[model samples]
Target: MFQIGRIIMPSPLLRRLLAALVLVTLALPSAAAADCYVHYKAKRTNPYGLHYGIIRVSGGCPSSPGGLVQSRISSGGWTILNVVKVTTSSPSSSERRSAGSHYYR
Candidate 1:
């Protein structure tokens, strides 16, 4: 039998496999925990104003970025032009503030 931390395994082979599984499981979260940011363009009616902004995606998934962008932006009556790009990096705080309240929330 072999012991790893608090977990015990009955055989050496089982211990190695268990250790591998544990390592993989532990690594999954950091991979999944990555945050994605979407930079986009949008427009509002009436006076017809246009703006560019960046938003942090919650789920960090493929569909989540576009959905989040549309839901957040359109709720304020802005029509989405396009999602320029999705990235794991965020702009500086000052840059976000420059986009104003209507941008990233």
Candidate 2:
């Protein structure tokens, strides 16, 4: 028997279930923060071109991934136009194919 605040938990099975639930709850955040996918559009002047691609971002997705996307593409002289979507899952095979050479593995 265990007393947690004003509640009495008398069953070992209940205690085990509660412990497992707590463990899962604690782990959810880290799992969610593990990886983020950013889909964006970018452009380059001079030669004049546009690109749509997806990139995997570590350290989780930010409220605004534009800056991060910009920095990642800017090295190639591409300027970020907009962040189309930010998600926790990887892009589908079709999405990846559409990105062509611009997709980051």
Candidate 3:
């Protein structure tokens, strides 16, 4: 109902809040997120043990090189997970993305 319906995220905080509001809509199992879905077969050579992930955006993800979702694996400590953005159909102009190293900076 989020992506297909009207979602009003007026500001960044509101957007985060709106996104948070929909978290309960998913029927996630604790063990399920441990296995994230990899859409691009070309990238996933060994698709055996991908760790957990949370769906931040609904429409697959933003179209950065990897796709529109981000994920991480946890051991004794959390591992560095890569975020991806993608589309099933041909992407539009807004879908293209460039990764920046200075995201946190």
Candidate 4:
């Protein structure tokens, strides 16, 4: 047991465990932020189609990773709507259900 200011504290082992937990929690954000998942809306002209999908962006991010998104979507002849969101995590297949085959396959 210990006392800090006027507050009583737990045993030294408990304090060390708490300190380790705090350090791990503090480190989580950087681990989570290490990857980039870009989500965007895109369209096609002739047949008139729209889609929302995700892509993994290499390097950091862009004001518009339009070129990155465009390259992937372009294979299907779709034009981009600029990156709507850049995230640190990728969407799970279950979460991508709405996007169907257009997902980050």
Model-by-model lDDT, in order? 0.77, 0.88, 0.35, 0.78
Please give the distance, in angstroms, between residue 5's alpha carbon in candidate 4 and its true position after superposition.
44
The RMSD (Cα, Å) of candidate 1 is 5.0
Candidate 3 ranges with C-alpha deviation above 4 Å: 1-9, 28-105
Model 4 C-alpha lDDT versus the unseen true structure: 0.78
Q: Number of backbone collisions per candidate, in order?
A: 0, 0, 11, 0
Cα lDDT tens digits, model 3, 1-105, are 134357643767777877777775454543243322222211232443333333333334344624333232222233335544233333333332222221211
Question: Under the 3 Å rule for N, CA and C atoms, how many clashes does model 2 have?
Answer: 0
Q: Worst lDDT window (10 residues) for model 4?
A: 56-65
Runs of candidate 1 with Cα error greater than 4 angstroms are: 1-21, 92-98
Per residue, candidate 4 scores C-alpha lDDT tens digits across 13-88 of 9989999999999988776557577888899998998888887765556656778788888888899976777776
TM-score of each: 0.65, 0.78, 0.17, 0.57
- TM-score for predicted model 2 compared with the true structure: 0.78
Residue 48, model 4: lDDT of 92
Evaluation by TM-score, superior candidate among 2 and 4: 2
Model 2 lDDT per residue over 37-74, tens place: 89999999978999998989887888779998998898
Better of 1 and 3 by lDDT: 1
Candidates by lDDT, descending order: 2, 4, 1, 3
The root-mean-square deviation over C-alpha atoms between each candidate and the true structure, in angstroms, is: 5.0, 4.6, 18.0, 7.0
For model 1, what is the alpha-carbon lDDT of residue 77? Answer: 82
Count residue pairs with overlapping backbones in model 3. Answer: 11
